[model samples]
Target: MTQTLLPATSTESSSRPVVAVTGADGFIGSHLTEELVHAGYRVRAMAIYTSQGSYGWLDHVAPEVMQHVEVQLGDVRDAGSVRALMRGAQTVYHLAALIAIPYSYVAPRSYVETNITGTLNVLEAARDLGTARVVHTSTSEVYGTARTVPIHESHPLQGQSPYSATKIGADKLAESYFLSFGLPVVTLRPFNTYGPRQSARAVIPTIISQVAAGQRVIRLGDLRPTRDFNFVADTARAFRAVGEAGPEVLGRTLNAGSGREITVGDTVKLIGQVMGADLRVEQEDIRLRPEGSEVMRLLADHSELQALTGWAPQLTLEEGLRRTATWFTDPANLARYRVGEYTI
Candidate 1:
């Protein structure tokens, strides 16, 4: 069943609870790692093993933040590695998965191996190790096309693409673990999280990077589709909120979003406004999702999260876009992106 671990806050290093995070080297994972460290938790971050010894985005975090983080090179797909990562952790924030929607179409098997199997490894390890809590990451894509406006956690899951399908599988596994074994788990479904350090695979970064690279004509897909974008910082805070909240959130799934919706076309216009650019649009067939696979709408109803954890979106779309644009416009940061190339 459930085991209660040490309290989240403590002044002494010996008293600080250890938290493990999978996929801590990627976009949201890296941000969440920094967030946990700032919240005074000792973080054991699992970065995918690579010969180059790259920690992905974790290498870019401030040295002060890195001081509190222990980067462990491992793969979530391997149960042994996942177990080692969670050995003594009080809580595990599982964010590792194959996240690129377009690539999932070409390599669906890889998504299953990494996303579905990887999640199983985390759940099994957490269950066996008696970890106090598991914060499993979910995405808005799982609630494809939003059968109703302001999608809630109860929205029917529609796997519009291979990536979403695998995430749905992972989410269900997490649910099964909580129900079958009373393993404490909370699934956090975030809608369109975007900000600095986000890769070009996401829409917000795609538009911002193109504009930052001086492209007057922005190439995008399905301008009609609308999304409820949440800033990365807000998303990171939501993870912490649920991770640290009392047992009321156990065995629950919560939505985190701005509760505001904007069409891709309008989003581009807004980013243009934020960057002080006069932009034009060029729809690209290659960039578009397959006809039936596209998720045309997603708007989040995060009221449940607010009621449970007092968490709410703090940055407006414009303010968030401004901050994202500022970071992308910086030459050093902008150089990291291949602006003209389609990343999918």
Candidate 2:
């Protein structure tokens, strides 16, 4: 059965193009929803339905922004709900997925359902409804530990973890839809995105939240892996860039990053520097990935995204870290996270 969608809250939004976003309640999705609103588009945001009526991060958005967003309670895993979300939408940004790496280890089947099957639902809905554009989300983890520095779009995909494997499957499915059905899809693969509203499961937030909670010795997993950490704002813009770009980007996979790399240890130190804390690291066995599953390095070659959409990361690592620290240090924001507890 088809689910009925709520009408736009404001009459002014009726004139704007309808852009549907799955997972608008998530970290990057919330930022992207706000970005789309700021760009004068009417947003249809899909938050996973729950009895508690929680809209995740969308519930915390400013009232003014909320006025332009229509929240639909649905799941990407359900075809009917996904089709309902996409109906009458000009563009669909598919971001819903189970993304925690450690959790993937515990429940690989959930990852398959949400990431792979959920993507299938999005593609089918878009194809059936004739949506103009579908901005499908991909992760740099598909490349695993980089075989070469500055991983490009053409770099070989290596799924070293269950999470990465599911994403790889999803990415391939997106490719097949574009090639097989001529669906207008652009895969925007973002490197490690970090900033405000990030869960403590992530390295940057983990370090920040611990230090904010007055912990001098930070507990973390292996600190030797390197990453190209893109700020959430820049990542949100990249999604819009691809979603709104012309057909030149159709069926193409693009990378979004700052083109800079920093090791986990150095990143921790940098966070300490930005927060004015002299922090120490204590490795925890539980936090460590299986020996072979750990991605030792990741650096993105985002030139293709720039050449195609003129999008480049605008924030420096230190500046982004500082901004993140500012948000995580806030009493209310810090209170949301269980500091000192290892999050999967």
Candidate 3:
């Protein structure tokens, strides 16, 4: 049986065309959803279905921001659900996925289904539904480690972990749809994205949450690895830019990043600097990725995206980290995380 989810609000009342976003309840997804709404676009925000009536990160979205949004409930893994969520949408930003690398190692099949098969469902639905545009989210992890200093779109894809492997498959599937079926899909590969509402599982959040909870020693793993981090707001803007870009971007993959890199150790120290804390570090084995699975470095060459959409990263790493740390300082927000626990 097909579940037909109509927009909860009437777009006919406004000139804005309705856009749908899968994973609209997660970190970057929620940020994108709110940004879309603020940008005066009508948004059909699809949160994963739950019996408890929760909307994940969206549950915390300001009531004013959600007024322009039509909240739909569905799973991206279900073809029927994906199709229903996408029908009548002019543009779709598909960000839903099982994203934890460590978790991917534990349950590879789940990653395959949710990331690969789920992406296939979106592409097929977009093709069938005649969706005007589809911005399929990709990640820097697909490049594994930096084979080159500044990785370009042409960089060879290496699946260093189950998470990245499935994403690679998903990206190829998106590319196939464009070549084979003429789906207007653009892949936006964002580097490490960090900001408010990011979960404890992420490194930035892990460091900050511990500090916010008054821990003097930060526990971490693989401090040698570096990442090209982008703030969630900047990443969200990049999505809109690609979604609104002309057909020149069709079937192309663009990188969304700061074009700068920082090692984990330096990043931790920066966070402490922003928080005015004198910090000690403890490297925990449990927090470490398997030797071969670790991605040692990532620096994005985002020139293509800038040349195409005139989009450049707005917030510096220090500024973004400061904002994120400030948010985590709220007792309510800080309480949501398990400060000292190592999240797999």
TM-scores for all candidates? 0.96, 0.97, 0.96
lDDT by residue (264-283, candidate 2, tens digit) is 99998899888899989999
Backbone clashes for every candidate come to 0, 0, 0
In angstroms, how far off is 101's CA in candidate 3?
0.2
Model 3 Cα lDDT, one tens digit per residue, 1-344: 11223343554426677899999999999999978877778889889878899999999987767767778898898999999889999999999999999999899999999999999999989988899999999999999988887999999999999999999999999999999988899999999999999988999999999999999899988899999999999999999999999999999999999989899999988988999999999999999999999999999999999999999999999899988988999999988888889787
Model 1 lDDT per residue over 58-127, tens place: 9998876776788999999999999999999999999999899999999999999999999999998888
* Cα RMSD, each candidate: 4.6, 4.5, 4.7
Q: What is the lDDT of residue 56 in candidate 2?
A: 98
Pairs that collide, model 1: none
In lDDT terms, how accurate is model 1? Answer: 0.92
Of candidates 2 and 1, the better by lDDT: 2
How well does candidate 2 score on lDDT at residue 105?
Answer: 94
